[model samples]
Target: MGRHDDETETSYITVPSFFKCPISLDVMTSPVSLCTGVTYDRASIQRWLDGGNNTCPATMQLLKTQDLVPNLTLQRLIKLWSDSSGPGSSPILNPPSGTKVPTKEEVNESLNRLMTTLSRDDDVRIEILTRIVRFLKDSDTNREFLKKKKTEFITLLVGIIRMKTTTKKKMELVLMATKILDTIKPDRETLSNLMLNDDGGDCLTAMLLAIRRGDQDSKIEAVRVLDWISYDARSKLLVAEHDGVLTETIKLINVTDSDPSLIEASLSFLITISKSKRVGSKLIAAKVISKIKDILMTTEMTSVSVTEKSLKLLETLSSKREGRAEMCGEDNGRCVEGVVNKLLKVSTAATEHAVTILWCLCYVFREGTAAVERSNGVTKLLVVIQSNCSVMVRQMAKDLIKVLKINSSALSAYETKTTHIMPF
Candidate 1:
C-alpha cells in the first residue's frame, strides 16, 4: 500500500488500526467476532480452535462457544475503505473470497489475456499481474491452475523482468512478476528449461538487478528465486558462473542492515555453491571466510540453522589451501583458535563441521599444525575425544591427536600429563 497527496497539503493516509486482525496482525479479509467481543480473521480463529485453544488469543478468556459470528457490516466497511482510491488514499487489494474460486477455464482465459497484453502495454500488464498475484496468494486452487501453465508463466515473468523500464509503474510490474514467480515455485523441469534458454540467463540478470536496485521485498524475492535455482547442481554452477552472482551474494551476507531471511537465503546459496571446488575457491577469494567468521562471532546469530550453514561453508572453504590459510592466522593463531573453540560449544552437526575444519587445518596446512599446537588446540582435541560425540567425530579427533602427538613432542608431554586425569 501507499499514500498520495499534494505537495502543498499536509495529509497522512494509513490503514485503520482496527481493521487488522489481532491474531494474524494483518488486515482481516473475513472478519469474525468472538464471544469475547474480539474480532479476528476467520481463518486464524478457526486454526486457533483447531489447535484446541478454547481461550481467546487476545483477551485470554474462555470462550462460551467456538461459533464465529461473521461481521458483515465491518467486512463491508473494510471493503469500502480498500476500494476507495483517491488523492491521499492508497488502493489495498482485497484477499480472495472463499466463495469465489475461479474455475480452470476462467484462469486459462485470464492467462491468455495477460500474455496478450504484456507485449503492448506495461500499465495494463502490471494491473493484470497484480490481479494474478492476488489470486495466487489467496487461493491454492488458483495456484494449482497456474501450475498447469508453469512454463508459459515463467517465460512471461522473465520477459517482464528483461524489459527495460525505469518508470515507477514498470518497476512495480517487475516486482509483482518476481513475487508471482516466487509463489508459483516452478518445478525442476521448468527450471531446467529456463536455464537452457538464453532468456533464463536474462532472468537471472534481472533478478540481480532487482537485488541491487529494488526494495527490500523485491530483493528478498529475488534472492529466494536464486536459491530455488541453486537447488540443482548444474543450476548452482550456472549461477556461480554468472558474473557478479557470488560477489553480490557475499555483499548481501556482509550487509549489516538486512532482513534475516535475506541473510539466510544468501547463506543457503553459498552452501549450495560451495559444493563446487571451483566456486569454493572463488568464494574464498571473495573473502567469504572472513565474512563467515564475522557472522559466527555475532551474538545475534543464535539460530542453529544459521550456525550450521556457516560452519558448513567454512568446512568447504577449508578444503582449499587459500581457504585454510585465511582461516589459519599468521602467527597470533586467533583464526585457528576461534574454530577449535567451537568443538563442543555448538550443535552436534556444527561440532562435526568444526572438527572437520580443524582437521583440515592440522593436516592440510603445515603451518596449521604448528598453529594448533600454539593455540592449545591439542587440549581441545583431547576434550573432544573424551566428550560424548559421534563415532566419526571421535575418530577424527583421535586421528588429529595422533598426528599432533607424533609431530609435536610438547603435545605428547601434555597428553601424558592429562591422560590419567582425562582418559581418551
Candidate 2:
C-alpha cells in the first residue's frame, strides 16, 4: 500500500526529472556525488555498493573512491523547487533518470516542456529559466545533455531576452536568460555562427543589450558569455569588432565598489578580448591601464584569482608598445612601482605574471628601471633567482637584474661581507 501510494503521489511535482536516482529510478531526497561525477540517491547507491558493486551504476566506471560527497547545490535546488511549487503545482513526477547521463528522450522531454512554459507570461518564464539554470549548474551530465541541443536552447534563450515583456518578474527573466546561456554555453562553432547569422537569433546582440541594461548580475553573466566566446583567437577578433563591447567591459572593470566576482569576470573577458593588437589598442584607448592599476592598488584583492587576473591584464597590456609605455608611466612609474611590489608576494602564477610585467617594462622596454629600483625590485629579483620559482620566471628575474644594471659592481657595498656579489 505504501509503495502504491508513493507511485500514485508521483503525479505531484516531487522531482523535476533531474532529481531522480539512476540505480532505483527513484526521487532523490538526498543526492550524493561519486568520484566519477554522477549523482545518486543515498539509499540507492548504498544498496548498490552493499550488493558488491564497486562501479557507478550510471557510468559503470570503476569507483575511484567510495566516499559520496553530498550534492548540496542540487539538494538546495530541489528544496527551493519543492518549496516554490508547494503542494498544488503542476504535475511532475520524480521525472526521469538514466544511465551514465540523462537519456536523450528525457532531455528532449524537459526542453519541450521548457518551450511550452516559455510561451506563457514573464512570471512563469522566470521560474522555469531559474530551474533550468540550476539543472545546468547541478552536474556535468545535465550540461552534457543540454550541449547536444545547444542551438535550440540558445535560440530560445536569446528570444526571451529579445522579448519586449512588461511582466518584470524577479530577476526580470532576461537576467535568467543570460544565466542560462552562460551555463549551457554555446560552443566555439555556435558562437562564431551567432555572430554571422542574421535571423534575429543574435546572442551577441542580446549580450550587448544585457551589458547596457546595467543590472549587475545580468551584466556579469553577459560578460561571461562574451568571455567564453573570446577564448578562441578568431572569435576574440570577431568579438572585438562589435561596437561598444570593449567600452562596456571596461566600464564593468572600472566600476566603484563593485562586486569582486563581477570584477573578475569583467577582467577575464577583457584579457581574452585583448589578445590582438587592434583590440589592445581599443582597450588602451579606453584607459583600461590606469583603471586596472587603480583596481590593483586600491582594492584589497583578497581573491588570489582576481589579483592574478589583474596582473595578467596588465601584462597583456604590457605586450603592446603603447601598453608598455602606459605601464612605465610618466607619473614616476607608479604602475611599475605597483608591479614590482607584487613580485614574490602573491601566488606562483601571480608572481610569474608580475615578473613578466616587470621584465617587459624594466628589461624589454628599459623604461621602468628607476621605479623598479625604487621599489627594491632588484632585491626581490635576486630572491626570485634563488627561490623555487619556475625556471622561466627565475630566468626572467635574472635577465631583469642584468637589464636593471644590478651587476656585482653596483651591489659590491651591500655584499661587502663577500668578495662576489651573490645577489646580483
Candidate 3:
C-alpha cells in the first residue's frame, strides 16, 4: 500500500519548472495538509491506487482503477505528452486502461477547434477556453505547454482585444487575459515589442481608448487595469514614460459632458501615480494642478460625489506642504486663506460628500492653519462655523474657532453668560 509510484516506474508527473523531482500530475503528490486542513502536493495523498486507484484531491475518494488515466481528455493528454517528448514519442505511460493517449497532431487539431469556436459567439467556446486556461494554470505540464504556445497565446489575447463584441464578452476576455498575464509574467521584451508595433498597443491601449470613449463601466474596468499596473513599481515608471498620456488623462476629467464615474476613475489613477514621489511631482509640473484647481472651484460641479473626488485630489496634492503652498500661492492669495474659503463654501453643500471635503480641508488647515491665520483666514472660517445651521457644519465652525482664536473671551464667555439670560 505504501509503495511509491516513482519507486521503479517512471512517474508521469512532469518535472517542475525549477526542480527535477518526479511529481504527480494526475492528482497532487507529496501533498502537505495545513492547519486549516487543506491538502497540497500529490504524493502526500494517503490513498493507495490498486494498479490505477487514485484518490480525489478534494474528497479523497478512492477512484476506480480506470480513472487514474490523467483526468485530461485523451486528445489533450496526447498533445501534452507528445509536445514534451518530441516527434513520434509518448511522454507518459499509457497502457490501455481504457484511457486513450492523444497524439501531438490531435492536440493541435483541438486547439484549432477552440480558435474556430472563439471566433463564433458561442458560450461553449468561452467556457472551454476558460476551463483550458484554468487547467493550464493548475497542471504541472503547463510550463512546457505555454513555452510552445506563447506566440499563439499573445496573438489570441491581441485578437480578443480587437474583437467587436458585446461589452460583457469583451470584459470577460479582458479579465481572463489579465489573469493569464499575471500568472505567466510573460516575456516582457516580447510584449514591449508588440506594444511598439502599430498593432501592438492593442489591448493596453484599447483599454485606455475604451475608457476615453466607452460607457462608465468600461472606463471603470480600464482604470482598474491602470491601477493594477501602477501598483507595480516598474509599471509605474513605464506609465510615466508614455508621452503626455498622464496629462491628457487628467484633462479628460475636466470635460463638462464626460461620465462622472469616468472622472472618478481618472482621479483614482492619478492618485495611484501620485503615490510615487517622482511621478507625483511630474504630474504637478504637467500643469494637472491648474486643471484640478479649476474643477474644485467650479460651482457647476453640483454632483456631491464629483465635488468629493475633487476635494480628495486636492487633499492629496495639499498633503505635501510644498504642494499645498504652491497651490494656495498660485491663485494670487495665501495658500491657507484660499483653502479655508473653499472649505467654508463647500461645507454648506447639501450632500454627505461635502462633509468629507470639509474634513480634508480642515486637515490641511490644521497643518497650515498658522500660515492661513497669518494671511487673515481665521475670520473667514469663524464666520462659516458660527452661523452655519448644519450640525456638522457647526462642528467644523467650532473646531476651526479654536484654531482662529479671534477673541477667545468673546467665544468662551459669551456662551456661558448667554446660558443664564432669560428673554422673559
State each model's C-alpha RMSD to the native. Answer: 16.8, 15.7, 18.1
User: Candidates' lDDT values, in order?
Assistant: 0.70, 0.71, 0.50
Point to the candidate with the largest TM-score.
2
lDDT string for model 3 (66-169, tens) is 22222234334444544676554334543232233223333344356456522343333454356456545555466456545747766665566655545666
lDDT, candidate 1, at 212: 88
lDDT of prediction 1: 0.70
| Top-down TM-score ranking | 2, 1, 3
Q: Regarding lDDT, does 2 or 3 come out ahead?
A: 2
Sliding window of 10 residues with minimal summed lDDT for model 3: 17-26
User: Which segments of model 1 are wrong by more than 4 Å?
Assistant: 1-109, 139-145, 199-201, 231-234, 330-333, 364-380, 386-388, 406-424
Error of 2 at 374 (Å): 1.1
TM-score of each: 0.66, 0.67, 0.43
Q: Mind giving the per-residue lDDT tens digits that candidate 2 earns over 1-424?
A: 1123454654432345678765444568899999999998898778677757787765567887899999999999877776775675444545443212334454465466567622343433553465566567668887877777757777776667666534445237777877777777777667555544553235565677778775777888888877876756667777777777778778777536677788899999888888787889889888888877776666464477877898988888888888877777656778788777777787888888888888877667677888889889899988777777666777677778888776656443333221222121
Off by over 4 Å in 2: 1-107, 113-124, 161-171, 195-202, 231-234, 254-256, 409-424
> What's the count of clashing pairs in each model shown?
0, 2, 13
